[model samples]
Target: MLSNPYFKSVLWLLGFGGMGYGLMLLTEPNAEKIERIKASGSNSKQSADDQRKALFMKRLQEAATTGAPVYRPQPQVDKKDS
Candidate 1:
């Protein structure tokens, strides 16, 4: 069974995976840093989403006031008869 090429490859892959996982665990960030990172990430994401929503609503209101099409289609180009 040990002489089988497939089994050998599987064992080699498992060994490398275990070592990588162990390294990740050893080098993992402290809990406080993780929490801070999570908090900042979430706040930034929320603020970005809110800004985007506000901008979109502003544009929609402007379009409505000007009676412009909310969704504009590309203008068709006329082919020149060379």
Candidate 2:
């Protein structure tokens, strides 16, 4: 059986799968820690989004007060030239 290619492949797959499953179990987080991790992740993401929005609004406000155009037209180029 060990000399058969299919049997060898099956053994390899089972060995790898068992090792991966064992590692997963060993590293699995408890429910409380999982919840805490999730909350922190969301909080950080929200704050990051808020910061980006504030920066964008500030830039827009500056442009508005300074009478600078926010949207600029792109220069036209012929495709054949490139």
Candidate 3:
């Protein structure tokens, strides 16, 4: 009955316990499967490189349309004396 103190306490405890259990399940790490999939040395990097090249080509095409000169920055490398 709704008037029973014991029944109210049990319901409250159950509600809090279920919420804590749900939180634990939600926060638990599930990244191991993703790491394992990525660890196979797949084509992710190649796809990324292809995307970058495609973007560069698109930019070049836009520059050609606008008659703009494309400049490439050189990498800074240290000169080592042997």
Best-fitting candidate, scored by lDDT? 1
| lDDT, model 1, position 23 | 100
Q: Candidate 2 lDDT, tens digit per residue, 1-82?
A: 7899999999999999999999999999999999998887764456767988988899789888987766774467768854
lDDT, model 2, position 5: 100
Which candidate leads in TM-score? 2
The Cα local distance difference test for each model comes to 0.88, 0.85, 0.85
Estimated TM-score per prediction? Answer: 0.38, 0.45, 0.37
lDDT of 1 by residue, 1-82 (tens): 9999999999999999999999999999999989998887764466767988988899899888988876884478999999
Candidate 3 residue lDDT tens string, 5-69: 99999999999999999999988767896798678866655677788998999989988898766
Worst 10 residues of 2 by lDDT: 73-82
**Model 1: CA > 4 A from native:** 32-82
Q: Count clashing residue pairs per candidate.
A: 0, 0, 0
Model 3 worst lDDT window (10 residues): 67-76
In model 2, the clashing pairs are: none
What's model 2's overall lDDT? Answer: 0.85
lDDT, model 3 = 0.85
**What's the distance in Å from true for residue 75, model 2?**
19
